[model samples]
Target chain A: MSSPLLEIKGLKKYFLRQQAFWQKWTGKKEYIYAVDGVSFSVNKGETVGLVGESGCGKSTLGRTILRLYEPTAGEIYFDGEKINDLRGDELLQLRRRMQIIFQDPFASLNPRQTVEKIIGLPLKIQGMKGRELSERIDELLEQVGLARVHRKRFPHQFSGGQRQRVGIARALAVNPSFVVADEPVSALDVSIQAQIINLLQELQEKMGLTYLFIAHDLSVVSYVSDRIVVMYLGQVMEMGPAEEIFSSPQHPYTKALLSSIPRIGKKNPSTGRIILEGSVPSPLNPPAGCKFNTRCFIKNKPAACFHEPPPLIEGAPGHYAACHLLG
Target chain B: MAELLKIKDLQVHFFTDYGVVKAVDGIDLTLQEGEALGILGESGCGKSMTALAVMGLVPFPGRITGGEIIFAGRDLCRLTEKEMRRIRGKEIAMIFQDPLTTLNPVLKVGEQITEAIRLHHEEGDLSPASGRRGFFRFWEDRRRREMAAWKKAVEMMEKVGIPSPELRMEEYPHQFSGGMRQRAMIAIALSCNPRLLIADELTTALDVTIQAQILDLMRRIKEDFRTSILFISHDLGAISELCDRAAVMYAGKIVETGSVQEITGAPFHPYTQGILASIPRLGEKEYRIKPIPGNVPDLGDLPAGCSFFPRCPYGQAKCKTELPPLEEAGEGRQVRCFYWRQIRAQREEEGGIGGELSFAGD
Candidate 1:
């Protein structure tokens, strides 16, 4: 088999919480496990979706892969090169090949910057100057369905959907092979969301781009991804092909997530509305073993779930779920 | 079934610096008692404006130009400011999207609920201060009666599933989480037992898990109180699951209105059909998500004929010149389209009931 474009192994990132007054006096520090351990790979020209709830570490995982946040542990490989260990100039070169499309269109771009400056900033940072940068900016703008005239207009002058297109254009300005789209359409309207999704698909095929699409919306993820990864409390609860994850979700958390999606036409038969009990556990004090053990609906959940961490085992070909029930 | 509220030919316009923006052009809607009606639309579609007009809370520079809002057989539009204030929270109450902003920051949760009840009761002339006000208002008997009503407010908090209602009642708004605050807001709105509850995206700001809990709670409370709800949201899936009937709004007009089944199973308007096809569903085979080309028309500078003609896929020559009237299409279905028959025939020819309406690529 050909090598994947991106490979992540045992990636982890922990954030240190603000020291409490007592802890400051005592000279103690506390850390919140944002991303405990995640591993995944994206094949060339393919999209892998990372799905999870708010504060579940999906975004952190994406940022760590892009090296926006330094991983506390684990390795990230891009195009057969160990990128996690790269630093200084070498890291800067790797950044040119990897870009991220942030979630909030309003906050991502500078309000004072014109569309030209916004899209051209990346090329400028790489030392492209004079007419060369302006020409490249125009081409990128047109590629994302924006007019050349819009280059003079400020970010606030455009609508939400338009602003996102400008963002996509900026991400592409670097001509990156891999892009991390972090909930790119979540802030957009439903009708407009389809526009952005279609644009991304078109861009992917045209640009031969691979993506790590992170979003909490399952429907959108399922529609866009070849493979899907479900995260719960900073750990991969399930990972498999999009079709398998949707058709036969093995993890209790995955099942609840799927069932929670309000179907358009069919009557919901399983009134077993699995409302996962309890707000997400504080990341600082995550439960041991399977993080989802506290809310698993299955009656036969093993005692090992609380004491021993369940390894991600294959429940079916190409389908892996971290659950003691499968064992 | 008796109609609880009827809004006819509602027109709301904002007198802006640029021009008089026709935010809500003309809308006609009816809500039956104990029934849930969902207003489905994108932002700037004027769905919220219709609700604001109903509540007599249109912001500054915006005024209801012409309309008849009949609630419980009375035309609310004609009521005086004083008369409407009397009916605002007593007969009708609104729950805004952000519970934090809707609640006063300084007041305790208990005081807010008590204030709602006290206002309604005082209006009904049932307060213990019946007559003697100047010097004897501080009497012990009157003070005891006031305290008793405040205690009842605590009881209302528990009815909305708030934990430790008595203790939590003393906490400020910031002390409660998003879901708990929404529940607190619901408790305050229900204290007067208003017949009609207008919830404007009450769960939109919440996460899906919390949203589900809130929806379930709203469903349970709806069953117990038999209160009619006008649930406004942009999420069609949530609306279809919760609302009995729905109205699809676009460019300040109702493009389609029908029972949830009819709206979801077979939408009649072109805009409605686009919205349904645009959303990607779970477990479905991957296909190119067909977005409606172009953008929603500017409310200030609307198109000549049909407001949706610019982005509509099936727009014809006549569509640009003549406005289509909203007419009953079938049982429990209304559509605003001159060529729905032609579009339906085309969809059939395509070997599907709901095919994407194609537009010429610009």
Candidate 2:
């Protein structure tokens, strides 16, 4: 589809654990496999939903893609150009096209800074100043549906929804082409979350922006995303069109995640929830084979699950799943 | 089937510098014995404050100035500080959203649980074992009672599905996982065999699988202990799952109260309906979001009439001047709305929200 806007191939970001004295003496080592071998492509003018449990590396992946955290391995091609090798001024120039919106609007925002300075800081950093920067700040604030009067007020003075709107304004300040919204609506209340989601959707349409929407919540991701990626521990479980993934999920983990969502009223007959027995395994020492095999609802799994890691292969036309059982 | 806790016209105000923040303004609530009542609301709705008022633990600068909290046969509001302390965690217990913070990091998990048990010991509990209860058996009874409480703490841990209760009991709150910590907290709350358990978003911090586990555990706790739960949460799904009846709160007032079915199914208050519509369901694709128009009004300086009128889609000129009273909408349903009857009639005619929102994508 027009040679995708962002293509990540076998991306891996691992952090070594601070070893104990004895471990260091004996040369024992371990790695927190936060984002391991993740691959996906986001086309221009599209939103790809990344769904996983808290420690499933969705945030890490999002951060690593934007070079907020450098990847230990693999390639990143943004706008059909190799970006993993970019340095200093070159990287800064590339970063002008990428931005991230954090989860906690309260924590992400500088408490002491006024909304105007917060929005203007990004523009000022990008060499824009004087009347143009102030005007651009006003436009950004208006674009995110915030009042002009709010620009002078501090972040703490605004409500959660308003603060989130401010966060959006800051993200759009530099006019980034690619945005990573990491659980943007998670910290907000339902009604507030809806407003933020609608704002993001509208902004995406108007600006022709591409978003890598990262969230633990499937419902939220589904609401605004065109494509959905399901991950467990640190590996992709299933990736497909939003409709296909929700309507007819292939991977067991995806099914479990979908069912675990507490919908109002009766449990749907379409997919009975399979509540996994154990909690997510530690990322530092993930399971040997398939990351999800330990908690996979599929019973009597073959030994291959514990031995061989499944490759992400297309199950349907555009749906990809990493499961040995799928052929 | 008698009412365990009855709160009538309860007004809790935070005496802030800005103004008297009416956190819980004139809330009328009733919870039956063994019934789980879910208080659903956004952050500033004062649901947590109501629970705190029930426990007589409203934080500093906030006081319950008016209203009656009738628990058992007596008015709880009339209780002295010393008397209220006896009922705080004994007859009524609460678990906060964050178990990590709610739990004492310095103390062992079991110690805290045992402390709750020993402090709120039933007078008759130790008497049976120590026969001939005269001047003598005081020291003997104390030792025996202490031993019983220790065992009870472990028993509670086991009951809430904490594995290796004996070992986990010795560990501090930080030692346990997120799910285990919540279970431990639940155990401590249930240790006193509290008749009314007030859980304020206990499962919010947990993951979905663990949330399911915790919710299932709470359901079991209610079934086994017949503990009347005043469950407060922002998650409607969790509310729908655990609550028999739910009250939707908005800016220090309950907009609607009904059975779980009515709250989720045929909600009269536009806020309740809007709340249900806002959360995207898992089963459906293209989650048609119909966000309420504006933010909840500044509680410090609320509007002339309805607090929700500023955001409500169905708000009219009449709503702007007159605050709607909480009136009986139908059987076992109370709604604070001026146009509920007409809305219900319109729903019957137009199938949903009078064509405003048509259960889009359902």
Candidate 3:
């Protein structure tokens, strides 16, 4: 089989914290480990979902993969070529091939620009001009299920779902081979979310595009993804085929996350939900060994979990988890 | 259980520059003493406005145009501002989605809880001439009241499961985490042991695990305190998990009302069916999310007939020109649809909606 379309190896991104004057004089420093030692890959025309809670660094991982924020360590390969260090013209060309759809549609789109300019800006940046650019903008609008008359309307004139469609159109304007959809549907209402998700899947099939779908909602991720990666406190807890992971989640963290979802039609809901002990610990000072040990609901957690970080070991053919108990 | 709150054809209209927006159109609702009734709808569907109208806290330029909010044998719409103030926290209290904005940033968490306690219980102790004539006695009474309130605040903090209530009480809202802040908000709302609690998307801002914790706390509150809850949210999962009965609102009207089980298992209205079909079940292998077409109609300029007529998949000619009153579909179920019987019959003939949405059973 051909190699994957994109792969990441040991990716890490750390943000330095501002220090006090005394700390500076004493030569002390601090860092927030936003994304630590994460590795994953996406095959051609397939979607890989990244699921995590807030402050778990899923968004940071997405941005770091796109080189929007430079990684402090490790490698990112696009079609088997290391693109981490690509600069100047090469970086610009790579950017055209890799685009992102942001979480907040209201904040992502330019309020002042009309739909025409918003979708046309990318093509214009790529050196398209006048009639060709305007025609391309109208085509993109129609592709995303918007009317041609809406091309002249401003962002404020549209509703939430319509604004999100505009955002999706902008991301697809440059015809990127890889797209990172970051919580694209979480901001939308339930009915509207389905519309956008269907639109994304349809566009993926039509354009032969690969996606890294990131969201906290597991149900949405499970619906749209081929494989799922569960992260916590800047570390991957488990990764596997979506059905296998949902059916038999090996990692305690994954189990907790799955069961925490409130399902309808249950006579007594939350009956078997494994309520975590406390909120996620501050990412600034994560736990020593297992990132989830602070809130892990496993019985008789191995003592080594407090000191030694477990390696990601494969359980099934493609299912992998990081936990001492799994070993 | 006795009827704790009853709203009869309640209407709240906002007169704007463009037109009069009927945020909470004429609707009837009732809540028993200990029942948790959920108001389910999308944004701009007037579920929140209904809760606000019941609390007598609708913002300016929005007035209760018609109908009566009979709560505890009095019409809340007819009450004066001063009279409504007395009923707000003591009779009914509301907690919003964002705790940071709802809570005072400058005040300590403990102080906020104490202030809420003082508002309802600080009475009969302050005599007529205590402020002027008996200054010393007034000072003594003030100290006693303050001491009592502080103790009650700590009790409330402990009751809400805050760790180290004594220490955390001194910390401000900024110091607490997102989940902790919500717990503090709940403590303040329940400090007086109000009969009814209005949670307006309280868990929408929280993460999943955190939301589960809050839901657990709310369940415990319902059982221990016997507080009637009017939970308003757009999340179907959360509403079904917490509420005994639910009212599904469309535009400014409640399109359906039934037991939570009936609403999820065998819905009648097309709008309700659309909402159920739109949610992607967790364990379903195939993605069959049948999204309801079109956006929620503009409340300011609604259609001449049914507000949902523009988006209903089963819409017919009669639905376009005439409004359908919410009729009794079953013993206690209600649905606003011209052809619900036909819709239910069609679904039954086409197998069942259950097989499509079945969860991965344990």
The numbered model that scores best in lDDT is: 3
Q: Please report, in order, the local distance difference test score of every candidate based on alpha carbons.
A: 0.87, 0.87, 0.91
Candidate 3 TM-score on chain B:
0.95
lDDT of 3 by residue, B1-362 (tens): 79989999999999999989999898999999999999999999999899999998889889889999999899999999999999999889999889999899999998999898888885653222235455488777677777778888899989999999999999999999999999999999999989999999989999998998999999999999999999999998899889999999998899999999889888899999998888888867675888988898899999988888999888899999999999998877999999999988888888766333455543
What DockQ number belongs to candidate 2?
0.51
What would the TM-score be for candidate 2 when compared with the true structure? 0.95
Q: DockQ, in order, for the candidates?
A: 0.46, 0.51, 0.74
In candidate 1, which residue pairs get closer than 3 Å at backbone N, Cα or C atoms, i.e. clash?
A: none
Q: Flag regions of model 3 displaced more than 4 Å.
A: A21-23, B123-135, B354-357
- Candidate 1 TM-score versus the reference: 0.93
Per model, the share of native interface contacts recovered reads 0.58, 0.50, 0.68
Could you report the Cα RMSD, in angstroms, for every candidate shown?
3.8, 2.8, 2.2
Clashing pairs in 2: none
Residue range B1-362, candidate 1, lDDT tens digits: 89999999999999999998899989999999999999999999998999999999999999999989999999988999999998898889989989999899999988898888877875324344446557775675456556766887888888887878889989999988788899999998888888899988888877667677778777777789999999999988778667889999998999999988778777778898888779886777545567888888889999889988998889999999999999888877889999998888887777654533221110
- What is the full ranking by DockQ, best candidate first? 3, 2, 1
lDDT score, candidate 1:
0.87
lDDT by residue (A228-278, candidate 1, tens digit) is: 999989999999999999888899899888777666664552276777554
Q: For candidate 3, please provide the TM-score of chain A on its own.
A: 0.98
- Runs of candidate 2 with Cα error greater than 4 angstroms are A19-26, A267-271, B122-146, B353-362
